[model samples]
Target chain A: MEKKTRVLLFKPGLDGHWRGIMTVSKALSEAGMETIFFGFKTVEGVVEAAIQEDVDVIGFSVHSGAHLEWARELVRELEEKGARGDFLLLVGGVFPEQDHEELREIGIDGVFGPGTVTAEIVRFIEENLGRKVSG
Target chain B: MEEMEEIRRGLEEWREAKKGWPERREEFRTDAGIPVKDLYTPLDMEGIDYLGDIGFPGQPPYTRGVYPTMYRGRYWTIRMFSGHGTPEETNDRWRLLYEEGETGFSAAVDSLTFSGVDPDQEVHGAAHEVGKEGVPLYSIRGVEALVENLPIDRMSVALVVEPMTSAAVTSMYFNVAKERGLRKEQLAGTTQNDILTMTIGYIPWGSLKPADLLKLACDLIEYCTAMGEAPRWNPINFTTYNYREGGIDAVQEIGMGLANAVAHIEELLRRGWKIDDFVHRLAFHLSAHRDFFEEIAKYRAARKLWYRLMKERYKPENPDAYRFRFHVQTAGSSLTAQQPMVNIIRTAYQALEAVLGGTQSLHTNSYDEAICLPSEESVRLAVRTQELIQEETGVANVVDPLAGSYYVEALTRELEERIWDYFMRIEEMGGVVEALNTGWLFNEMSKAFNKRRRDQECGAERVIGVNCYVMEEEEPTPPFRTNPRAAEIEKERLRALRAERDNRRVAALLDRLRGVCERRENVLPVVSELTAAGATLGEITGVYREVWGIWQLPFVA
Candidate 1:
């Protein structure tokens, strides 16, 4: 059997908008990734899930303007857990295009905003997984 | 079977008659999976009587219109939903709309208030949205300021709130009116006290369990029915607008709507309340989406079906209870952020369909909705869009203008059939409450939402400027930025109020609420008292949480 990549998808904020997360989760799973769904998780909960699942990527699907704060806390959480470099962190949802570079500067591997199709996210995770393992 | 075979044979011969015919798949269908015929004929709508089924305007079944003259008698209210920055800010916006010739008023609150949490207590909020996404209605004082100088007695108010927080908000509104010397009998307003939408559609911040919310909603209805003689307040607007945004098709939107209303009616009936006491005041919140004809048919079918449900099931004596009056909002989900200005044209078509479908009130989404709360310029354009429809276009001059068209009639009948089919299934599943509790409705919505998103992504479904007619690397307009100081000012105000208010009196009010809640008594009286006594939203909800416990249900899918 091939070593299929595993991804952890989490909802980090309050706006219980599940359409984006639900669609992305289904897409990742259908794209042959072992997806672990984490909802309403604190930054620590997300870090814990990522480490426990041994996921290659952790994606936070958030609404509102809280993505930056959540991503920062998540990066801090992973750094505190000593696994900051082990997993790639991607943040998606409702962020303005200008905030994308700032989010990546704060150690988010990639940023996907609203109207982003599922195929792009799936491909991004797969390619990032390849870079992580091959390196 | 023989006649069916003969027609099928003729169709096969007709197909063979064309030598260079295009290889077209005859499976063209609507978004709701209703098959679209090549051409509709009178045969498609057989066995349907026009007068008995639809009748004239302001007549039985109410399929034509709820009023005799329809828009000619009175134009549908242009109720633009505006709230942000603070209570005072929202109040100013409301006054502006009134000055702009808008008729109806809605007081909207931010997520923190809606979730039964104080703005100072937002857990996941980055502080950017505290009072800016909507008003920070954390205190009765704040709520009073929202409707302070406005005419509470005369205005047709629609509380832009869900059931989870409607109890607190509704009581607050009544208290404000009372303090302003307006009797409850003079109140003309609506509260969107829909529990199904609260639990399943808009996954709100954590609050009371679904069962407690249902009981609280019933309490409001009962209080309104028993207290004020000739009450004009609607205790609930069973909503499908919320559910539609969660990813169901047009059929399921109205299906869930009818089923959810049945759930509410059944619950109230079990309490031995007379149907006429509350059913007349029970309105609906529906959506006008991109499915133009389908949406029009959906509204027509809903009115016809609800008339039957109210007449046959409960048998209310008041004919007013049978007429369904609904408010429609152009679907925000249909708007695109890429070519945001195109949303104007999109909204124009949607608003037209809503008017054609006989909505009583309408809110056209601003072109900037997909990016942020509507900007003032876009909001004016939206209001003007409605005015244009009302004054310029004579679409609303006739009642049920599309009633006789073969496609519309067939689709309306088909939608009725599908809605009844849902009723049977929901009945067998015990009811809508059971369906919601078992996550059946949530699962159905999630599945639909996911599949629709995937289809749009893969070109199976088309959304302009999203997956089709697309622009590569298009520049997005600047997102609407919430004033950062709004949170700051609101949080400080909350702290000062807590420090200054009579904590003991607040405690007593909360205790009374808890007592009523525990005894399963009508909670609205105590809720009104609590709001009047300066009890903060968090404090009242704290008492409820202590009584009903907290529920943290995620979306089923």
Candidate 2:
């Protein structure tokens, strides 16, 4: 039997556009993943929830262009706490294509912008977790 | 018999060959929650009567339009929605848009100011908000700053405000006009005093108690109705569009909107106000989404429904009260941040749809809406989209061009039935207020939203820039960038305005305003007094908070 992948999804700013986050949460839950939604969190708030929840991966669903700096800042926080390389970080929303390379360098393993398939997001996380189990 | 059997066997083989070639069938539904049929024939509209359901344009129960020549005589007003940073910035943009052929102004205030506060307040900066959402207004001065270069007397302004603090905003605009030596009779504009829906969605922001909100809304309606003829106050805005953006299908949008209209009418009738006195100023703010045919039908059905409800149910004597006048704003959610230019095309299509649907006025979304505040270039393009439809398309030559078409009439009737079902369902649940309180509407929206997302993931629906026709190498930088100093600039402006004004006058007016709010007197006159006295928005709102208290949002957010 395959173990369920626990994913903590959150919004990092005061922005209240929750349609994207809510829809994704529904998708992950339907796909049999234990999706914990920490609705509208600050960077520090998200970091604290990650530790408290002890999840397999963290995904930031942001639309307000502050995702680039936020992603970089969260990665640094994870590294300092020795949580880096242990869990995967995923980013989604209306991110421009150019920011993809920079986000990856900051320890982000995946980038899902407009037109992103929820199944693709689920598959990526599941396969990476599967690799860990097999290795 | 042998030859016939041989032919049947060959046909069976042909049928088997086609078995797995096509994708799964998809369901099509309007945003109003109406399930759309694949085809509509005369059979579908068998019960509908041409003279009764959809009569000539400008007639009672106007399914076609509120006017005889709708677009033929005058095209729908190109009402551009523009507000950001400071009043100065917003005002400058308004001038630019007008120069680019925009026919009217639709103001978008910052969230802080919209909630009735000064830009320099503590809540403004912590939200990382500032001019990110809209222009920050403080008092009559901010209103003055917004219309400095623009012609106030010449233009029609639509203040997108809820009833809670609309009196104060409208009073400030009136005060600005008074200063400009323009008569109240000369002011041509609309203020969205739709109080019912303010509490219907987003539990955090609406008037907490229905009775109190209704009282304030009634006061505005009464005040505007008495102002005599220049038609300054647009007291009621049936915001079906807001719900549409939040994922409610079209039928629910119309149904809930009509339910809200019913709520307003019931309140007014209970208060002994004549129906004709208050209904004329009522206007609708509709969303023009991507669905071309369905959208047109939705508008047609809305007009007919409103007209019939007013005439048959209320029996309002005035012909004007029975007409459904509305403004259309293109859907922002349909626009993608990726391949932002494609939004221009999307906006143009929606704009054309609005005109064909017989909108009184229209606001086409800027291409940059998915990302940030629209730059001047993008704003101009949005305005031009409306102008192009008016000048080039020749679509404006008739009113409701698709009215008599069998497909359109059938679709319109189907849409009417679906919306009526929603209205009935909500009424059974103890009206829109109770439905909103219990999260029934939100649940419906979430369910539909999930299905739509599933379709996108399963490749049932195609969003060109989002799910299909994506470009991997294209890196087009957006033209607009929000100034981080917007908060600071607004703060300085607020401080200076406060320092320069008469301190005693501000204090006296605010104290008087607090007294009136607590005494159950109509707060409009008091708010107007405070605005004229040069009191800040924060001061006015603080007084109301002391009297009425802030709403505690019901949701878990």
Question: Interface RMSD in Å per candidate, to 1 decimal?
Answer: 2.4, 4.3
**Native contacts present in candidate 1, fraction:** 0.37
Complex DockQ per candidate:
0.47, 0.19
Tens-digit lDDT track for model 2 on B460-546? 667886678878636565546656687788778777878998999878878888788888777777787788888876677677667
CAPRI-style quality class for the chain A–B interface of candidate 1: acceptable
Residue pairs with clashing backbones, model 1: none
Tens digit per residue, CA lDDT, model 1, B40-93: 665565677888886888888788778889988888989887888888888888
Cα error, candidate 2, residue A83 (Å): 9.7
Off by over 4 Å in 1: A1-3, A131-135, B1-25, B122-129, B552-556
Which is the leading candidate under DockQ?
Answer: 1
Scored by lDDT, model 2 comes in at 0.75
* Candidate 2 segments whose C-alpha is farther than 4 A from its true place: A1-15, A31-135, B1-45, B124-127, B194-216, B226-231, B545-557
